[model samples]
Target: MNGCCYGRPTRLPWGVSFPPSSFAGLEFGNAKIHPSQLYFSLAGLVVFAFVWAVRKRTGPAGTLFWISTMLYALVRIPLDFTRAYEPETAFLSAFGIEIVESQLSSLAIALFSLLMIMRLRRESLAPSAA
Candidate 1:
């Protein structure tokens, strides 16, 4: 979320002040954008561990995939919250309320996965006694 995707162009305090090609065309001098670098790389490892733990609990095979996706999104919400906002597309204004699109999307993804997991777990636990 902090690359060319949507993060705002920022001026870094620790850098040489020069008009590089990437920043030359930009409006502000020395305002650097993320250089296609990694954001929270450790998050992937954490998600892997979470999925592994859940799988070891006898979770359904696909539950591992679902939990992985859900946990990643859950982490994204906070990451985006602290991230630099995109100058143009950071927030949506509607009904007199301003909301961050990234946060909303992350939240939606997390909720969807949680509901799916719960439904699958409930079904799996149901008895055939009738």
Candidate 2:
């Protein structure tokens, strides 16, 4: 998908050009668009670096996984805004906030992972039952 941004010309790997009418009213017309795939790839590398760096310092057994998951979602939530996507057709769209399906899924995953991390931390810190 193409995102609107003013920059140097983008070279599509497919080596094909679309006419102005090719894209359903998007009007790309050989215009440069944000390289969303590259951005996502870079974000993934960054997330991996951060998670790997802190792996040994996590609070509990499952905390690292949850932390990494939440971190990825946090990154994805903002990253999705940079990409062109269909807005969710729900009641929230009525409020004028354009949220995509990926963003919604990321938000849910982030929240759930956070809750799990907190629960794991609490369990790790509680008195031992043994």
Q: CA lDDT of each candidate? A: 0.61, 0.70
| Residue range 4-87, candidate 1, lDDT tens digits | 332335555432333444333243356554322234456778888877776778465567777888889988776563344444
My TM-score estimates for the predictions, one after another, are 0.65, 0.73
Please give, for residues 1-130, the per-residue lDDT of candidate 2 as tens digits. Answer: 4433212234655323344554422445566555566677888899899989998998889898898899889998887655554334332464556776777899999999999999999999999999
Cα lDDT for residue 81, candidate 1 = 38
Question: What range of 10 consecutive residues in model 2 has the weakest lDDT sum?
Answer: 1-10
Candidate 1 wrongly placed segments (more than 4 Å): 1-19, 23-37, 92-99
Off by over 4 Å in 2: 1-27, 87-97
lDDT of 2 at 33: 53
